[model samples]
Target: MTTPDKPLIMLVGMGDLSARVLTLLLGHDATSRVVLAGRDAETARRRGNLALFTAANLGRHADIRSVGLDLRNVAATAETLARVRPDIIFMGASLQSWRVITQLPKPVFDELDEAQLGPWLPMHLTLNHLLMRAVRDSGTGARVVNAAFPDAVGPVLDKVGLAPTVGIGNVANIVPALTHGAAHLLGAPVEEVELRLVAQHYFSHYVPRFGDAGEGAYHLDVRVAGAPAAVDHHRLFAQLDNRLKRLGGIDGQLLTASSAVRVLHGMAADSGVRAHTPAPGGLPGGYPVRIRRDGAELDLPEGLTVERAVRINEDCQRADGIERIDDDATVHFTERESAVMNRLLGYDCTSVKLGDCPHWADELARKYGEFAARFDT
Candidate 1:
């Protein structure tokens, strides 16, 4: 049912979250043609066919297929992208998920917390860097939506001129959850509640639990029925406790997927529109963005300049243990994060040069696997 004029969306991961996104896309009016690409072509094909079957069962027809995509091989990836020339690309590829990393004991987690979650930035950046290069070389104006650690990775990629169009999750996820809480508190319909959040990725992890997020600077603006509505942060955040949707290995993929779909929908729409996303065009962190058919534009709330917004998010990165992302795309980890990595995993990487990301990713994956296994038994 796909026509030549319709858009082609390429999804470059088939992990737990990616698969859920595929299913969710197929269940709705996903008019675009989707190519599910991964390192395992056969596995991707199997998942693609399953998605098609599910679509058929739901009385929907989907233009879905699969292909092999090894992001490490830039030449091959470029050749593939040049041939397909997809309109949009959604990258969900990572060696590991944050869920696995969150399974450590509280004391151990807190120790690692001092360094924060910044040590894992390389794992999230490796494949995405190469994929962006492939897009650039292919000469295709493909809008990319990164689903990795965009809170930090987006700026790193942007520094090297390989920034994705926008980042998924983070603020995108938080805004909706906050909106739902705001709507419940106001006794208004969810759609009637307009929520804007200027924050970073770190807040999503603990906000739903303790509600004390982002070093005590969680910026949020709420309005109901086109009228200003004052929100009691204490009361509003108290409702978030019941919405703790992730536990250990399990995650709230449904929320992440729904938010991502909105970004994609905005991409395919004719005119530009606004949505909350993390790291739009590789800016420091999450911001409200005006997504267009071609790309996205930063739509930061009124009175917030680009520098101030970037400064706020950049300062927030320390909570995740990333000291700074230099002009050359080099990422310097905080001393605490480096020491904890060395002591716990016998691995040491204080700074990561962007070009050296491939090697770092391979080593970090092995080390993280070993670290996670220690807790399994």
Candidate 2:
């Protein structure tokens, strides 16, 4: 039912996360168009058919199509963006798999702590950076929604002036879970509970591993029925994790997809809807965001300064093993992360310079391949 004048949403990456987003969008709004683009047009088509069929079964219809695209090629990617001129671009392409990496041979992965997470930042940003570059070259004013490692990746791209409009998933995923917990504790409806969080990617792992005992200064304010709720943040996070075992990893495609869809719906409607999301306007970590037709802005709750929220997230990055991303695009991994990578892959990459991402990405891919093969049995 989409007409020529309706906005076109181009979704890159036909991975599981993108598929989930596509399915949800199709069912929710049949009047908009979606183009599923990836390296494999055939595969994208297959997925598109499934999404369409799912929509049909649900008594919904959508105008959806597929296109083949390779984001790694700068010129080709730019050409596609120029040709499409989409109003919105949802980037879900990534060289690494969340499932494969997270579930690496238990022994090898166990040796590395959260502070060692920075070494993989290059792999997460490669395609995302390329797509952002393509957007710049195309001269199209399309809003971008990055679906890959936004907590760490978004800031890197932002430093280079290529950050996406907003990133999907991350801290936003925790809001609803926490809201539900508060609602249950207060005996209030979920709709009546409002939770605002100021944190980063590390909290996603921290809550799952230690729950309330998780170390970090994350800002959490919960309100029920227009009054402050007296729920303990730690206990609420623990309750959330206990309620859902799939808070982390690719199993979270459900929450991530739904979060992105909410943003898209807000964008399409041009309403300044507020939602919790990671890296809105390309700042580090996550915050409450106000999405409107003009742009997305951080909506940090009362009593929190932008500087303070940023400091909180920056400090938590160490928990993920990343020291900092320099203005020159050099990503300095925590010493522990670098050592772990050196011991595991024999690759001595202490820091990843912006232009050298492809080399490090290739090396990491090779190392990860070997790691996966060894554990295949």
Candidate 3:
């Protein structure tokens, strides 16, 4: 059994999936310590009901308490890390609630920089960089597993020397659910199914809901490690259909959180997994990741070529902003996405790309400037 000093896990955020994660971690390995943290106990508890329900449904018998944490007080987070001496830290605290923009008139959104993914990149990436620093400062050998917008945030965190041990949740996260259904229909063991995906956020965002990608769902191929294997596309799609059915019409934040869970569970498994997230920690788009038992580490998993990854991201980035970004140059936030961010927070702020963690402290302040002002009581 791993002792207390061996390494505990620090989970930031008390959202539904965050608690679900705590429960899953305990159910998966009860001996290990799991810290379920957040800023407000009341809100955390309120938001954590789904997690609690999911835990009970899973029949998790271990005790995982809700820990309150104020992210604004960065030092407190540092203190928690110092105390837990965690082996793995999962940062799922930040909220990725950008669905509102989708509801606005396409004409208005299409014209603004907020329409692009880059503008608000700073909003999410800033939170990640701060937390990454806390994890690094902990100095324990704990590997950190990050959730949320890793396609952009993970890489930015990496550039400043505070990269996640591994990033969880991305396009790669959605592939497995498809793989399993294909495996079952083909009568092949799930392990034998191999999938190669070249996808972008646009597909990840709209496909499951609208099935509007125009590509007839996602194109997935399965094969035994070295041999070709048959796949049942209809059955495979049935699985995707079921998932979207359940997730249909739900709040975007809730759906994103659920997506977070699928990614988390896959990353937690025994076999190694590869995913694309924002790596080099400050890049414009996502970078691929390699996940192992101890923690997630950076490496563009072997199958896909770097050139292919870059080209896909560049295409996605262009669709996001009014001006297209250069494929080779690191991309940052866009004007439309930034406008949406301003409308949401009532401020105009920009995101720092992969190399800008040092500026994150200021950026976060600017991003949160209004909300903090209005709510300061």
Query: In candidate 3, what are the lDDT values of residues 296-328, reduced to their tens digit?
Result: 344543565666666666566545541342233
Backbone clashes in each candidate structure, one number apiece? 0, 1, 32
Q: Against the unseen true structure, what C-alpha lDDT does each candidate score? A: 0.80, 0.80, 0.53
Model 2 whole-model lDDT (C-alpha atoms): 0.80
Displacement of residue 356 (Cα, Å) in model 3 is 8.8
Model 2 earns a TM-score of 0.93
Query: TM-scores of all models?
Result: 0.92, 0.93, 0.66
> What's the C-alpha lDDT at position 257 in model 2?
91
Off by over 4 Å in 2: 1-5, 105-108, 112-116, 247-249
Instruction: Pick out the ten consecutive residues of candidate 3 with the lowest summed lDDT.
Output: 321-330
Candidate 3 ranges beyond 4 A from true positions: 1-7, 30-32, 41-60, 63-66, 95-116, 176-193, 212-221, 224-246, 249-290, 296-303, 320-331, 334-377
- Ranking of models by TM-score: 2, 1, 3
Candidate 2 residue-wise lDDT at 133? 91
Model 2: per-residue Cα lDDT over 1-377, one tens digit each:
32434568899999888988998888556225888899999999999898888888989877788888999898998898888788888988888855566676666666644334567777788888889899999998888988788888888888889889888787877777777888888889999898888888878656755556365558888887778888966667788558744546677778889999888877777778888777888888888888875457888778889999998989878767788889987888878767877776776787888888988899988887876687776
- Model 3 has an lDDT value of 0.53
